[model samples]
Target chain A: MLRIEGLTAEVDGKPILKGIDLEVPAGEVHAIMGPNGSGKSTLSYVLAGREGYEVTGGSATLNGVDLLGMEPEERAAAGVFLAFQYPVELPGVGNANFLRTALNAIRRGKGESELDAMQFLKLARARLKELQMSEDMLKRGVNVGFSGGEKKRNEVLQMALLRPSLAILDETDSGLDIDALKIVADGVNALRAPDFSALVITHYQRLLDYIVPDKVHVLMQGRIVQTGGPELAKQLEASGYASVQAAA
Target chain B: MNTVVHSGAEGFLHRFEGLRARLPGQRLAWVQALREAAAEQFRVAGFPTRRVEAWKYTDLRPVSDAAFDEALTILGDGDTLPAPRGERRAVFVDGRFREELSQIEGASFAIGSLAEELPRLEGRLGALARPAEESLVALNTMLFEDGLLVTVPTGVAGGVLELCSLASRSERPSAFHPRHLIRLESGASLTIVEEASGPEDTRYLHNPVFEIELAEGAVLTHARIQREGVKGFQLGTVYARIEAGATYDNFTLNAGARLVRNEIHAVLAGPKSACHMNGAQLLRAGQHADTTTVLDHAAPDCASRQTYKTVLQGKSRGVFQGKIHVHQVAQRTDGYQMNQALLLSPDAEIDSKPQLEIYADDVKCSHGATVGALDADQLFYLRARGIPEAKARSILVEAFLQEAIEGVTDETARAALESAVAGWWEKEAA
Candidate 1:
């Protein structure tokens, strides 16, 4: 469902991701573990089509379609989602209203019928309940004054509502407590289907224990240096990235 | 070399002199003296320019150069009052109050023309009619024909009072000086919504002045909505005095005029008085809007809060100058002021100066001003959520202005102001 080959990205003339190759088939989950500044977040941003990140030499495709050429909104409408490491706080935009707009935008782009306010509210209420969130969250401004765990859960809620085919979780587990980590993992695990794929980016092996990735890759200095099964996470957590860096 | 004295400053002074000479009834000595003093001040101050420190960002050259003749009497049939929308309506046409169209239903309310009330309270007129140092205020005082005077009796709950000023004409460059005097007696509570509108194609000048007096323990909610014509020029001044234990709240929304200036001067005269002033200005195209305010804390334990937001697009310009002054005697004073501007276009400009002057060591005062374009990261975040770029920008802009609008106490008036803001956004996009 998602593929990246020779992805060389640079920010501010400094090459961050030298070369990256990754693939996640439908119904599979791939975990990318890296040290700080090893371009774990850069890969997600590049895949999400954020501006100012120069893709010097790379090709990223989703479902055999070139994702690099699309705008951020276009990529979103094409079923690409990025759960931000830090969710932005929109001071006046209500959470429910923003979710409805986003849902309708994606649905309209795909030639689907748009949901009315009543329908949108019903759908949002059920999703919020499923995520163990209160209806009061819908009335407040989007993520404004939200606790760290609440922001992470809100991001998962958005992913569930949008139902993007390809989801990139960039450091989504960094700030989550143990309970929040389980809730977020449950959210991700529930969305795992034959048509949906995920790229989980994290700095520790803690999140992997909950989500249980199908494949694990060690990213060092902007390149994938090692690949293994779930045991790779355990080895890395036991030995740390210093040995990984020495080996690379 | 033969040089003509531009009619910009002198013509209005001459017309005011002519009006004074034609007065038939016996006038109060203090009223006459105030008129003369205002005329002299107008003559000396002339017109404000960009060189003045206070008016550094706004130049009144266009208004000074325009030949604004004294507006002739425009007495309309009672049918043109635009059907009163709220309780207690006062209509002012061409700067003069129309008693026939006004509706004063309650017995505790007294509504009349300031000119008519001047002779009766000659001694109080001087105290209320202190000459404002600004050139526009001086001009409005010198040339004002008649203004609205409203007073709510002590311990009276006057409900809501609507002051509507409508200027409609296509002939001469008419000018209106609509002054408002509102006195809320002790323990009295009132809500005043000042609505100003005019023909979209008319080229007129509106120089309005509102003087408010809040007795001890009184509460006043004053909201001013300016929807003047696109070709019009508006220069309005609001001077309010708050006594001990009184509460004064003001909200000003400017979405009109080619050039507009709304100045507010508030004084917390007695201990424990509080004042809250908030405003929003949305300007597009070649529009120029200015909001200048000063809060004087003269008594101990007084508090003041101010917030002003401006959104500029196209070639528009916005100016905000807010100052908080805590006197030496005003110990334990708490004052905060903030001015923020969102520049939607590269060519748009915003000049903001938030100042705080505190002579008391025990005072708490702070001021901040910021000018920037929309956050690119936020924009991208919204876009990634499948929201379009235009809608994302509007959402952010609305968020930026929401805090100011939330300060409006009246729900209906607040909704109206929000609608006005939405209308401005629609026009700006078009």
Candidate 2:
């Protein structure tokens, strides 16, 4: 479960997420649709504890554990994952090795036995196949020389490997074609379960169609203006953010 | 003469006359001439000072003042060598070639001591190293004791040859100078792995030089790994010259010694020849490693590359100086040089100078130098996956060095160097 109450944050001393209040219970996928400057990414970064984002006020917690007080890695150890809109390129790190290291790191943090190279490779290959990513991508450097679609799928791949309880997909559907959108959606949909939850941040309803959400929240100007059933997405698509804001 | 007061270079000159009788090939005229000339050069340029452009970043005064003598030959029966991954291994204890300790695979081509083959190898000894302006190389030529002579006949693929220099346990601070000569005839090829190591507590100086000559169409791969004693000091140099259509590849890994300087000079003498000079240096506290290279492109259409990476931890210091010289006639020459350093600690320091002197307007040459700490973005990327900060830092450093290590074409050599890097990571983690 994820909860945010008046989670105000700032970047470069400029207020962004003024006062966001939201909750995503277990076994549900939530969609946050907003305009370009609605602080959607700012919210995700604050939750993930990325440096340079000052939490001005309010609190955010996962399962009653304070998330803002943790390091980026500590938050990850506490089952918080943020899939960046643009995955950072590691010039010389192999993708397979990165996956294994991340998996083992989380495993060790949780007091579980770490997976050896063989076990990690086996698990990675299976999940990569499901995401339609070639095994060659495993040999290449992480996110290096990768296409836009492959980069997004790699984010989903990490989500699969770490199996985080709260995955904040920041603009996961920003740069995908129809086919790439379907594959990425398939990867996310496959991970849908009672224990797994995601905050799919997007500006379009196309991705929401592929990975249908249980709750749709219209985020406008750093605040969630409206929260409704899945049909709220369709209504917003037909009219726009202006009409949605007026109605709210 | 008054200026040579208890200085390192003066110390060598003081013992030169008495040590001449113990020197190998003492009876040979050309060998004696070389010694006299080199000794004269060393005396003229005492120990290089900071004012010297080449020695600007490295100060040799601290450990250089210690008295050094010939290591007493004390071979321990319990001292075992790692399995010879090469076809033959010419092992040296202290500065003398050990017949019983060495492993010579077969009689393929002429392979023996320079002392025994002095008459035949006299003219070829310093032929490749024409420019001995580097005082250290000149010093090595003067006090040279014993080394190996590996010659590959035309068109013969000389299997991997490991030239090993092992310093036996010595009570007092001692020194050794080994002059290794490698000559590959036209169409011949060889892979050489040179390893230098010594006892942990034995304070010594190992000054080694490699003279390499590749004829037209010859290919030679030289991988040198220096894991000297922590209390030891090493001043190693490689001088290589390649002819038409020949290929020369040299890789070095510096992992030990309290102070070390691995210098390489490569010349492309003919058209269409290619040369690759690469190395990696890993240093911890109280350690200093420097790798300097000079690549000369004398003919057109020749290609040369130099990549050196250093990972400095604790209060260690690392330096890299690479210079590419494209001569007037070397049109169409392609030369690339890069030096990158990763400073793990705030006290760690790196000085990198990548230079290009292009006389040929038609040539293409590029040089790059970078001094940076572990990348924050890369660290966050790894740590965000639940990896601890220390582990993430190690992974990124390994990745940084592995990029240059991948340039080593020989698979086994790459693996050996990779494991060495991994071993460094483990030690740092501990």
Candidate 2, B302-332: lDDT as tens digits: 9988888998889999999888889999999
Q: Over the stretch A1-248, how does candidate 1's per-residue lDDT look in tens digits?
A: 89889999999999999999989998999999999999999999999988889899989999998999998999999999999998999997888889999999999988899999999999999988888988988899999999999999999999999999999999999888999999999999999999999999999999999999999998988999999999999999999999888887
Candidate 1 C-alpha lDDT tens digits along B297-382? 99999988898999988999999999888899999998988899999899999988888888999988888888989999889889
Best by TM-score: 2
Worst 10 residues of 2 chain B by lDDT: B1-10
- Residue B232 of model 2 has an lDDT of 94
Relative to the true interface, what fraction of contacts does candidate 1 keep?
0.76
Q: Give the lDDT of residue B313 in candidate 2.
A: 83
Instruction: List the DockQ of the predictions in order.
Output: 0.70, 0.73
TM-score of each: 0.92, 0.94
Q: How good is chain A of candidate 1, measured by TM-score?
A: 0.98
- lDDT at position A62, candidate 1: 91
Q: Give the alpha carbon lDDT tens digit for every residue of A29-112 in model 2.
A: 999999899999888888887778999999988988899998888889999898989899998889888888898888888889
